[model samples]
Target: MRTPLFLLLAASAALAQTPRPGVNYDEAKVGSDPLPDLKLTTAEEWTQKRRPEILKLFEDNVYGKTPAGIGAPKFEVTATKTDALGGLATRKFIHISLPDRPAWPGMDVMLYTPNNVKAAPCFVGLSFGGNHAVSTEPDVPLSTRWMRESKEKNIVEHHATEATRGTESSRWPLEMILKRGFAVATAYYGDIEPDHADGWKEGLRAAVSKEGANTVWKDGEWGAIGAWAWGLSRIADYLQTDPQVDGRHLAVIGHSRLGKTSLWAGAQDERFGIVISNDSGEGGAALMRRDFGETTAIITKAFPHWFTPTYKSFAGNAAACPVDAHMLIALAAPRPIYIASAGEDHWADQKGEFLSGKFASPVYALFGKKGVGVEEQPAIDTPVGDFVGYHNRTGKHDVTDYDWTQYLNFAARHWAK
Candidate 1:
């Protein structure tokens, strides 16, 4: 028996309008019990006492535990061009190799420092494609790593080709970054671990695990996001050694999944003085308990390798999770952090991101720093905050010139002092 077309259409419409339980869109619906009180009077006391507990909760349930004391890698400068980016910048391509692991693959680091500064504060993040894809510089090396092919982007056969160069130039804005008197450093995320579930076999995850050990990650064990965050820390290790880099002022920034990585990296590694998240959404800056767009069920099912096994248990039960996104933000207390959102990127939950910043304000206050100043979400493109910053720009899910403008301004305001 076929249902009437009118009835079916009406049913579809109703279904679309109906909101799912635990998945809230209305700001009024957002309510959670107060975060655990550490009972510390000073911010320094909170950092000494509560911070470790919060970090442990995230590691035990969310991004999983990364091993401590991962030794430094050997850095080799493969190519250096003093006259690059039309002589306004100097480009350096470096090879990073783990000790006694020749068979394990090494990663490449690309840097662009402004010629005018002896030591410049820099923005460091992982890039999606090869280094050559970030800029059109002829000297930048093409990546031989396993790449996801996109016919639209001109990548062919799961490999990067000449056509793939500078395909992601808009996201990078290298010349603009250099002109702002800040150096830029990036490495391919795949160099540390590929995005797929099986990619652990080919990357550092497997190499670092004990020989003959089960490579399969257990509950609370490190996942791909953990591995990528670990990789960024390694880059920081290298930057500290470079005379041309103002290591103390480095900002780690990323978009989408990499944005999540940036937050996690900033939380675990205090070497990053500033952290920025561009539409990081649920696992990045959005409050998970809001049960807003891009619910835990959707994320974990799509990217099983991104978080720990324990994380999956809280899929439909967000309240059951011990730590929410606000706690993650609090982990970076007292440090300058920025969270940006796109008006059209609902899957990333713009309002939820703002609320996370708001909830995190108390932790910042404990440290004698202000978080995002406004109680409500600010107007589009109107960035707000003191030590913590946030803005929801009018756009879809991607980085833009407007975003960079705000970032540069934020960095100058906080780090210039």
Candidate 2:
């Protein structure tokens, strides 16, 4: 039977009217290009041939290639407290800078190691708030850099105040983590560059660019996410030199946007044995093709500075994108990776995050490692999977004790041996 021309036109109009700004909950309405295959049979083939190709696709199409000419970071230990955090741990503040780039404002790194441990496994992450915001201690110096304005978070006039200290302490359970025999190293993400569009002018990106502040970013040039990932790597370099840290067991973790940063950092640098993402949507663990809560069109428009300018092309036409979130997860193959979501974080596409890990399972199998084994998404608060652990916790988008508990357990399962 042939369909009438008018009826066909009506159907096309309805399709065009599908809300681009609205959330999509129906599976039938979702569309995705088939994931790029993990076709190689042996680890050697994957490492030598296929792996590099996938990596290049991401470098060129998504996060952009990390620039190579930046000078090595110089570290200065400005303060050391042997009896910090109520004598539960030793804390140190290290000022990191590039000697060649005097114009750039470098970062301050805060590290805490357990009191009795000879060598403790470390967690490396970037905080949206500064080091002072992460700890309740009064001695921790307040960050003087520009911060995203948030009256509730206690930032006034683009600067963090005394009231901002320990505001994000709940997100970072330092006392619990230290008692569990782990060290923590963190730096403020803004220290690399502020989150706004024009932030690059004052950051390392401009300092290293040949054209300086006036330089226009090319399509595949590194973006804010890449710059932040580079900062994380520099912190890792310093950890390797610390005798109190178990450098071999270092884990990279982040929540929300920083979660996206950690994934990119872990993919590029293999020094992190465990990788964790919490509520990282859109450009993070959620599949970009899924027309779910947050879409490619939305993220690219709102946070264009976070990715390669070429990424903007995939908005509303995600099927044409060469890579998907699953490929990003695959890049961390054989390593213990954990993707976490919250019950109320629909904007992050919780199910989509789980599916990325599921799709990446084949790569893990190639290395004789397990992945998210369940065929379907588990109920909220019920943790699942093996090497690729996942848990849709029972709350909103923020990180909680439940999420941290899973990460600690997952890290122990893989690293405690």
Candidate 3:
């Protein structure tokens, strides 16, 4: 049923692109031929090669023309608490209050750390459910936010809400993170006004009267992804002041659409030490050129608010867009960027994600860092790259322990302290 419509749209899209040839990346543009050697005889050349390339990549791909120039956020810790996880029963919850006023119902960050704190590198993420659902820990703060698809029918009465919390516990293993000396900090993605086009007028942008202020994203403007990514950046700003967190070694991670947010946040904010994109197919780590799974037309038609008004027109005309996933990835050059996918996740384009990583290599090579796994895509379970990483794990779209293992390994290599 839907397949024929997709074919017709794809056919027309291919026809439209036939008239004007786009960026000439057809030839294999690898190695030093296109990128002449910099004067790397001194330390200055190394910094120049590394930092500017990373910055430029962000400029072109991620938050096009946004301020990567803003100063780090000042975190004002308003509260703290602890709880124990299931195994060996050692985990805790620390609630942080962000420093932005009239409060605007500030984000709730629950930090899961090892019982013994020498401070470990954390794999932080934003989840659909609240922190309480991340683990079975009895003490983790019960979420106060409204969950959309919960059995809890009434939020105003608050009687039926007790059972509603901690229902999605299996997906988030906060206890597993703590036992391994890693801290997991998470916030409900919907705390910023349940991710829709219209509801955004009620969140941070409007609630605080911050509408139409001096910023890259304006009032009633930035979509759910941007708002979520912006929230993640604010979380990054909070992490810098924590003694329990090694902020210099933090890894920003997310799954599916949130995976897209992770990549965008990593690209926009340099404070994030590394990035992990799990099944972030289109508008993320997968190349638009491949058009394997999710297409620009589908994303635009369904989720109109996901991108700017300018982005919707490129639905069938994606080839006309100035950027591709590889270019989006180039935005994280020199920094350790990991693009992960599942073998069965056709909606996210497994092979196309691999291609995007491979395509971003020239930019990484500009700084002598390996970008993809190898010349060809490796079999599932094999991880690759010290700088830019890629792996196709066995299973479906959602993230797993296997995916987490690769990200930790990548983090260990980059943040070797």
Candidate 3, 1-417: lDDT as tens digits: 343332443343343223223322222421121221222333345445644654453344333333332333445454454435433333434344334444446677776666576666777789866766665556556677655442332323322155546665555655555666677777877666555445455455444444423334422244557667888877877676777777877888988778888987887777777888988887778776555566677676655555555566566665565566776676676688999988767667777788778877766777667778488887988887767898998987666878777776677677774
TM-score versus the correct structure, for each prediction:
0.91, 0.94, 0.77
lDDT of each: 0.84, 0.88, 0.64
Off by over 4 Å in 3: 1-83, 86-103, 150-160, 208-221
lDDT of 3: 0.64
Clashing pairs in 2: none
Clashes of 3: 2
How does residue 311 of candidate 1 score in lDDT?
Answer: 93
User: Would you give me the overall lDDT of model 2?
Assistant: 0.88
Candidate 2, residues 265-384, lDDT tens digits: the string is 999899999999998988999998887877888778767888999999999898888999998998898788999998777778889999999999888989888899998999989999
Model 1: runs farther than 4 Å from truth? 1-40, 211-214
Cα misplacement distance, residue 136 of candidate 2 (Å): 0.7
Query: Residue 322's C-alpha lDDT in candidate 2?
Result: 90
- Top TM-score prediction, candidate number: 2
- Position 355, candidate 1: lDDT: 87
